[model samples]
Target: MSAFMTKTLKALGLAAVAATLAVSAPAMASGGAAHPHAPKEGFSFEGPFGTFDQGQLQRGYKVFREVCSNCHSATLLSFRNLGQKGGPFYDEKYKNPNDNPYVKQIASEFEVPDIDTDTGDAITRPASTSDHFPKKFANEYAARASNGGALPPDLSVITKARHGGARYIYSLLTGFKNPPKGLHVAEGQHYNPYMAGALATQWSGDPHHVPVGGVLAMAPPLKDDLVTYDDGTKATTHQMAADVAAFLEWAGDPHATLRKKTGVAVLIYLLLFAGLTYAAYRKVWHGKH
Candidate 1:
């Protein structure tokens, strides 16, 4: 092949590679932009030495019960889990949550549906410690039907389910806002920068209607001083979001304390073993070299 032709081919290949990268650059940027609003906040249970603030967890549970529970369900959690060791309402004297009065009281507040054996008819009974958290709707279809075709997601393990976990939850809870000018939010859909749904509308007329991020089905459920904190911590929206995020993190990983403890113990053991091994090696090789 001629040198000139070879050089031309090489130039074309380089141009093609550059063009490919250029085309993909916006996609990569857009993917990152999707989560640009998720602010990473510090949590009490974040580091190795971290632990859940019992008071915060209790406050968060209150928020969840009053607000989020109206739609979402924590199916993996039971009333008893609330009063278990390392939990918010744990009682040292009543390690078994069944014996915990607080647990029983919380359980009794909810009525579980059941079928009567003799009557063969559905009946509602007070919830027990063993009963899982009840769903607000009977099923998915019912949930969607009630909420204008938007299904409220089950919050069991939600902290683990999302990409950024607790921080993401906190951000999302506090991130709801009006869409920028020229952006069209559809009817029944609320604007949330951190959620994953988009509003439906033709974008030809509006300059800013360029496929913005997803719309939240649920309205902004939190507000300033929404829940009166028993501890007198100012009930700011940020505070509530943080507390609820922490509580959900615990709900998703109830054994986080034990896991961290075991991890610390193992690390200590490994360090001691390493030191002892080095000492023995020095003793064995002393004066030999």
Candidate 2:
């Protein structure tokens, strides 16, 4: 071939390679960077007049106890709290949660770390009503090492920590899906659209149409029939996720219901006081104006 013809063919090959790279190169933060917004879920305790669904709370607690406690901890909670007023297991008969038989039973089921008084050595003992929930891992480092360098966040206050609160938790638990074609998921990582993260680096498809969502170290934690509900609520994955999310929300703000109730009372008092004041003002000004 003539030197000019050879040069032209080389140029064409280079152009082809460049086009291939543009189509298949790892696209960073383009469409893949955009996080898909999760839709809001309605809950019993939402509006100013709203109250928590006692049955839902009870089921949620069950889900947490049976499944979530395996890897996540709720240090902020004491078993006795379950029997407190407005708690999941609250009973009118047991005014004091510490004395509630159910709470005691639940507490006794877990062995908490303690020191043997006689030997002054670390040991495990049956937990009491006052004891906080046992941690799943000894420390953050241990938690990370055990779970591919990712620490399972404490569920006690997770609802407060995340932006969408309970709804966010629900979305994440149910958001796991097969990644779009051309998306690269590393070993031990999974795709979840509800999780806030940039997946552009893992996207090997169209730059403008990269899939939404970020890579998560946690695999799908919820599945159908994962936890059998005591109340006989069907244990679908959606129900489990919703229940656990509700439980976590309550754990985060155990006093939230009480606070809302208090606000209502305060508003009522202000309204009554204002009405009394208006009557008094009318009486004082009667026939004097």
Candidate 3:
């Protein structure tokens, strides 16, 4: 009721309103014009209880190796990582990936460029379990030069880097289609609705027509039956997209399962501690308050 108290309450109310707006601004901006075609898709790793499907992850890896790897490089992933716990080959008999025969075979298939210690010259040799996945292009300049001036992004953490995460990747992979009537697609540009670079405007000059966005440099990378799944799962376009998205999500955060488990354990401990503290407080204050 005092003037000072009234001013203090008003300041607190304004601060609360400002905090709410700051929190909600990102949500609003994310749903705005830049991402018109971002659609949510059901993922096995969506919720707190969600876990990565090992089979799907394997299939996704195959899709990536056969298709996406030609353009995008997952430099962070190593051949041995595929055989590690929480990965596609986690159940292999050997605990050490280097000792796993399957992992060894996979690593041997790739020829890695190495420097010859004896002759100070570059040489190519079979990749070892220790080597990261080989990059298709030598560097960013080479990648951009090959892809019509647009550099192919690395797949290391693309799922986490983009908005909508797995769902956005899935949608973009499957969203390629013929441009709508009156929409003129430029040469060397592909039409993809879900791509952040897709443009909604025509090429013709019109003052009213505004540029929406640019076109994606990458084309529709996934196709039906592109990769043969060892598990007998049909390799449809949608299936490949979903599988690769899942795999990318895992690659982005290999320790997601452990993190979730730790979170649950901490939550349980906090709940038990709160209950014990409340019981102790009740006993201490009994018949006193």
Candidate 4:
């Protein structure tokens, strides 16, 4: 072949490679956009990665409050109750460990509340809304009792006051299934299609069909032998689900305590802006007539 022809063919090959890269770039960047089982930050649940281990939750909380909190607010959580059951928002458990300064700082900031058994009241002053997050469940029975068969969700801030919110959150959490057998999952990553690519576990057909992992992820976090409660109540998978769901529900709705204040502030701002706009309009037209 002539040198000119060879150069032309090389250019064409380069263009083809570029085109192919462009087509695959978005897919590579977004591993799990098409599937429902994608894990999103703050929204995804880590299941096969592991169930709701209290110790793990503590670490997760550290990750959330330290890293994720800059963009996302757990406005549903209170600053006071971080150490208690609902979330690992506190760090006292690792006070003795010299390696965990993050845990030590969180634990040092506040005191944990003890519950009163005799009258069924909090033995200590409740953590004020500004202090930290509240316990997800006052107890297991309490967690189950809230939802009318559906688990009562916490709304410290993020709940579906409008359309599609609940479904979006639910789908992201439970969407991880078995990636087609023997698929490799990277460390610190959970299996999810909505966030990851199509693993062997995700099959086509019915979107509503539960993935191979389980039906609704909200169902089982605590199973027999999974978690041990101090109160002697078996921390069954259902109970863990109920507890974490309740805790998340609380995290999503923490602003309930300040809803009135926020509403009033918004009302005042709107009224003032409206008045200013009206006055400005009148001034502009005042010279017309």
* Candidate 2 structure lDDT: 0.77
lDDT of every predicted structure (CA atoms): 0.77, 0.77, 0.74, 0.42
Off by over 4 Å in 3: 1-41, 198-214
What's the alpha carbon RMSD for model 3? 6.3
Better of 2 and 4 by lDDT: 2
Please report the TM-score between candidate 1 and the true structure. Answer: 0.80
Report the C-alpha displacement of residue 273, candidate 1, in angstroms: 1.7
Write model 3 residue lDDT over 77-186, tens digit each, in one string. Answer: 88888878788777657788777787888889888899999999999999998899888898888988999999998999987787767776887788777765556787
In the range 1-289, model 1's lDDT, one tens digit per residue, is: 3365456556655654564454222112132225532234567776665788899899999889988898898989988989988888999999697899998999999988999999999999999999998888999999999888989888879977776677778878888888766666778777766665534462445554455556767888899988888889998888888888889989998888777777667656655665575577668877786
**Reference-based TM-score of each model:** 0.80, 0.81, 0.81, 0.29
Candidate 2 residue lDDT tens string, 93-144: 9898998998899999998999999999999999999999999898999998
RMSD score of candidate 1 (Å):
12.0
How do the residues 1-289 of candidate 4 rate in per-residue lDDT, one tens digit apiece? 3365456556655654564454222212233343232223332222211123454344334334443333233434554444333344434554333324443455455444767888888675533434454445555466566532334444454433412233333344444455444445443335554442454453544555433322222321223445455445554443333344434433554332244345446555655665575576667777674
Residue 221 error, candidate 4, Å: 4.3
Worst 10 residues of 2 by lDDT: 23-32
